[model samples]
Target: MAEQPETIKAFVKLGEFLGDYCQFAKGNLEFNEDQIKWLHKLDDLVARAASHNGWFTQGNILYAFEQWSTALKTDNLKKWLDQYDIQNSNPMTVAIIMAGNIPLVGFHDFLSVLVTGNKALVKLSSNDKILLPFFTEYLTTLEPLLLGYIKFSDEILTDYDAVIATGSNNTARYFEYYFGKKPNIIRKNRNSVAIIHGDETPETLSLLGEDIFRYYGLGCRSVSKIMVPRGYDFDNFYKAVYSFKDIIDENKYANNYDYNKAVYLMSEFKFLDNGFLLLKEDAGYASPIASLFYQYYDSKEYLDETLKRDADKIQCIVSSRPRRDHIAFGDSQKPALWDYADGVDTVEFLLKISNNN
Candidate 1:
């Protein structure tokens, strides 16, 4: 196997290839014969990924590619890895249980294991089955040394030195029971929220709409709730997000809107509606698709305390405030390489385990 610097170079090349693939995907790249064949296969995957999981829309899949292309730059990779003391050591088999919420949801974990020189035993969620394996194959082709370092399995996870699993709250209990004894990073359901200060520009709110509607709000990074100042009007918020109003035209989204609306009506619950989106006064963080739950906060101090109190349940907090923990508006989906999921440093964990082994 190659050394650390060589591995990084190979992955950087993989990033360049993905950048080209993204352009090819958009029909903007002049394709050579090899590029044409690669694009055809990638096109097939993008076309059919959503059929297995309706939430993995074509646009969302492409957006994922765009984000990753930007992220995999050589400078980005170096900066992300610079803070950690990565070393050459015995490779441990790290089993990853991927979540199928959005396209490539478990990619950060997979990347963490491999980039830190560990073997990845990936069990894909049936919802997101095709894209990562295809990417892995591409990676191995770029650097043949990766052939033995990556694996995909459908059987029960075994022979792993450490574990990383993402699942809903209920499934977490099972993971804890089965893999609790091992070094692990297990993630449960968490949602993002936006703190609206009542002075946000129409443009700002429009960007926030991306944080909400991206991937149909299936990603843990997607904003499902908003905390607004008391008596904040819904008119501007509704108008700003109207750009995504056509989302209701999609059959699955329309069905969700119709079904959720009927349930709210039957239950005699009061919720504000702008024809396409529903807004309700709810204290919960996880909101169903087609609807947004909101709470009215009195002060920044209160909002800060409330957020800190429930920090374990939240992912990204979208705000313009200059707090260390808050991510700027619209940036919730574009996490940097070091922005570890659940705030756990996956790379550091891998480095530590690999060094010990």
Candidate 2:
């Protein structure tokens, strides 16, 4: 069997595994009454498991599985693979450093390596090691052959054909310094933002809550800030977003919000009024809070310039205007499998690895 055919076979096997996983997710994991009850019980166990470490919480566990299942759909995986000519390349090893901000944030990198027929040496984040193993355990059960190719390591970072690293601006600098010599994708601190005109309805704003608050505003895809017209009243926005109050009870997230809020108040910084959150107008694109951070623009021209000036740091721009392909409020975090970050085609990157080998 040629390498390309073997690679294709692996992808087909993965697709079959994903199909089963999707069924399990939708039927058993997500909407199942029995499973929901089990999840509640599992939450208690997870809380106990991480009690000393102070890392994992019930919400984190739930969201981790939720994202894992969402990304595991057969159609989504197949769609991502379609863009590449995977049958041509036979990559040996691909190094990936997965991000830890959101649950299963590294799944896309995992998919890229798997579908492209490369052995994956994953450097899992300390904050996210537990969940990745859970996902791999399930995969092993589905297709034991896959267990041979996927390996997790805490140490032994090394030279590879290619690498992918996601991190903050400060960390990105270090990644570039270390991994820049290799064919690599080093992602810097970037964020999604919204462009809101006054005409946005309450329903739309509520959906935006999913973009802003889901995973407690941790994911890079999660909207960290908004661009609004000056003097915009936030009464409707607050009313819409109040439904997510439950997120505040999630220990780490609540602490983040409270801590940032306290720091702002203690420093006596002037911020725009949003009732629930203080929108500090700043020159930068990203903000600190788990809440929605926003900048006010007096005119459309100013908004355009602001976007252009910070284009490199911006990820997705959600807006009601039909001008751009801006996703709806809740849809930001739920990116389709085809959606690539930093304008880089992940499948293409993987294909390059396979082809170069």
Cα distance off (Å), candidate 2, residue 279: 2.2
Query: Cα RMSD (Å) between model 2 and the true structure?
Result: 4.5
C-alpha local distance difference test of each model: 0.88, 0.70
Best by lDDT: 1
Model 2: per-residue lDDT, tens digit, 314-356?
8888876635557777777767667888878887877765666
Q: Residue pairs in steric clash, candidate 1?
A: none
> Which stretches of model 2 miss by more than 4 angstroms?
1-57, 272-276, 322-324
Best by TM-score: 1
Cα lDDT tens digits for candidate 1, 1-357:
223465677678767767787787777768788877887898898888878778788788888988888888878987888887777568899999999988898988988888888899999999999999888888888788999999999999989999999999999999999999999999999999999999988988888889998888888999999999998988989999999999998888889999999999999999999888889899999999999999999998999899999999999899856378888888899999988889999988888877777
